[model samples]
Target: MSRIPQLVIANGTVVNSFGRRHAHIVVVDGKISQLVDATEPVPDAERTIDATGQLVIPGGVDGHCHVAQVTGRFRTLDDYRTTSTAALWGGTTTIIDFGIPRDARETPLEAVLSKKALAQESRCDVALHGSVVRWDETVPWQLEQLAAEGVRSVKMYTTNRGTTMADGDTILKVMREMVRLDGLTYIHAEHDPIIADCTAQHADDGRIGIEHLHRTRPELAEETSVKETLAMAQYTKAPVYFVHQSTPGAVDLVTEARARGQEAYSETCPHYLTLDDTVYGSAFPEWYACCPPMRSPETVAALKQRLAGGAIHTVASDHSCYDLTQKRERTDDVRAMPHGLPGVETRMPVTFTAMAEAGSSVEDFVEVFAAGPARINALPGKGSVAEGFDADLVLFDPSVQRTVDGGALHMGTDFSPFDGRTLAGWPAVVVSAGRVVLDREGFHDPGAVGRFVSRNGFREHLAATADLSAATL
Candidate 1:
């Protein structure tokens, strides 16, 4: 018989989507059992975490990331074990990663199951977004099977041709099928033709530096794809989520879609909200390269406003880390450089800093970083600190500030995109499933403590229907 976990976390302000309160939390059998007033006596428990003067919130949920992805020539540095360790230390208790299909023979269901198997090495709970690389008679059936098995979202790409890109017809078909299966379609939106043309133009002009990668795939590429994807979502009566949205134009498209009552939501990354295009002008700009690359500071400011106003739904770390050597291998050639940054461990601190600086409250922090992700992706027992919820908590000190160093983080990387940057609100202690996985010292693996979560919730956040096809763009 398993021993009942008894833990008491005291003298902290419990922040959640509903509200905030000074309370003591009780955990029993890996679930939040009670929230008593702070003035009340501490409950008897085997373990106690003193959270005095700390903001005790539900652990963060990173909804989009690529872990141990091996695609043709591109591969992420950190696999499930290292990624989950980094996430725990960073205050994220759950992460939703992609199960990308590598070949035609691999079905989406098989890919998702294989990915879940790999995540068994994780120390934090993990979920998967199923991918469809090819559209055939079997693809729709595969999507239905995946949804039936608790995979609530499917990832599709409108860019990266010759790799994961799906044509317009394929994208439309997937969206319609997701609607039929009661799932969400997550899209990586970028117009392939625009990217190809821009790449050829830059190459012909002999401008192949790392900065040119961003120049080649400009805002128009993302904006155009988002517009088209929204149109399709409207036509098919399917909800769509655009991942790593960077440009104001793309934001505008999402806003318009929402106004037209299309179930369109988007997630922005820390790099997009905090960093700007000037990184491309830095001496070693290759380190800042990523898909849907960072934009100007003005755009960042606008996106921040939207996020603060709840125009944007969630913030996720598109955390795809490649070794520094891999990044520098093609510093002189923009097209060959690996595109990604080590960000899983930095998402919470960076986002917390952004929100606090904007005068947002801890409730807002819990909503965007935790509850919103759980509600959107339908990860049960996550993203909240209420009774019956998973006892995943973070004792975060908002006043504490620290400079980010990649080598110091648990990810498999040599550098950080936010290196040397100081941010407030660091996680002093982290708990996962009622287990103390991270303390001041470091992470402690709890013997395959992470479980594969099969998600099914797909809550609607928009008006019912408005025939957006006939509406103005």
Candidate 2:
């Protein structure tokens, strides 16, 4: 007979994909087996966690994070161990990180395998999004192979340094191929030509301040790129996802595209919704810098409304952190600093506060943070806390208040843009696969049995529940 480790999370309000309600969740054999009334008696099992007056919700699924990836001369501060530790502390149990190809050396699969190997000892579960650098004939075959190995998503860049931009024909080909394979294509939307033109113009005019970063990129750049990507999605009938959408114009484009029955979805980061161009004018502007630069306060408010109305599907940190030494070097020259922010540990709490301030329900948070990301990644047994789902849960104290301090966070980053800001609703207890990984004190351990998840057989599963109409918007 096999032994069952039975544990009961008693007297807590259970928040799942459906919604939040008071219930006692029973965990047996590392899976949620039953949900009973909050006052239910604990069965004869291993242990019982009293979650009175706390919200027991599904562990967060961070759909976008950059762990152990490098850019230019600066390497990311958080590796698998550190990043996963920070994630666990923040109640995020699963991560979908990017796997960028090395410069002209290894194949996509080879690069993914190397990242997988590096993340083998992660403290939390992980998945990969195979980033396509130079799209070519051989790329499709490599993608198919990656899909076979459980890598279901491919990332294509529209504008970046030293990266090949996929023209219309190439984008159409890749989109069609992904649709045929029942996979997803994630796009970094920014018009290359417009951005190049703007950058050159700004350089010539000597208007290269941190504020000029937004001018060079501009809202039109994002809008044009988003419109183009939506058109391609319509042309090829592929499920398209826009990563880190930053402006109102881009949001409007996605809203219109979804109305047309196109499969277009978008994810906006915390930085875009919280920070703005004023950060660029701050004494330490480099700390708040990122691609698709933050827009005006009006754009941020619009993003908040979109999120509340379900116009936006997902929220991610885009948690890419680099040390101060490298970040400051770009302060003098806005283009030199790597584009990213350190946010894996803060994505959840910050969003929760923002939504709560807007009178949004916990259902809204669950939909955007947990369910939407899992569905996008095609991961089963995740995104929910119902019976038969993985026992990944977070116990939140809605009244707990804390100030954001980057130096105090567990990630390897040296600072945080959100520093000194106070927020409410923090995770008091975190459980991953029926095991406690983080509590009020800190992480349980550095190497606590995190695993690399394979993407095999995910497409068929997603196809069964995929609402093509809902996916596009």
What overall lDDT, based on C-alpha atoms, would model 2 receive against the true structure? Answer: 0.82
When summed lDDT is taken over every stretch of 10 residues in candidate 1, the lowest stretch is 461-470
Off by over 4 Å in 2: 1-4, 446-448, 456-459, 463-473
lDDT of 2 by residue, 1-473 (tens): 75545778888988755657788888987788988876567554587888998988888999899998876566787789899988888889999888887575767788788888888878889989887776577988988888887888888888875743556666778787788778888898999889988988988898876657877888898989999889888888888999999886787788898898877888998888778888877787778778889888888888888887788889999999787777777565666677788898898889888888777788789878888898778887778888788899999888989999888998898898789989886788899988877776666884648767776344576674455324422
Candidate 1 structure quality by residue, lDDT tens digits, 18-113: 778899999998899989999998887898888888889999999998999876687887889899988988999999999888766677888888
Best by lDDT: 1
Superposition-based RMSD of candidate 2 using all C-alpha atoms, in angstroms: 2.8
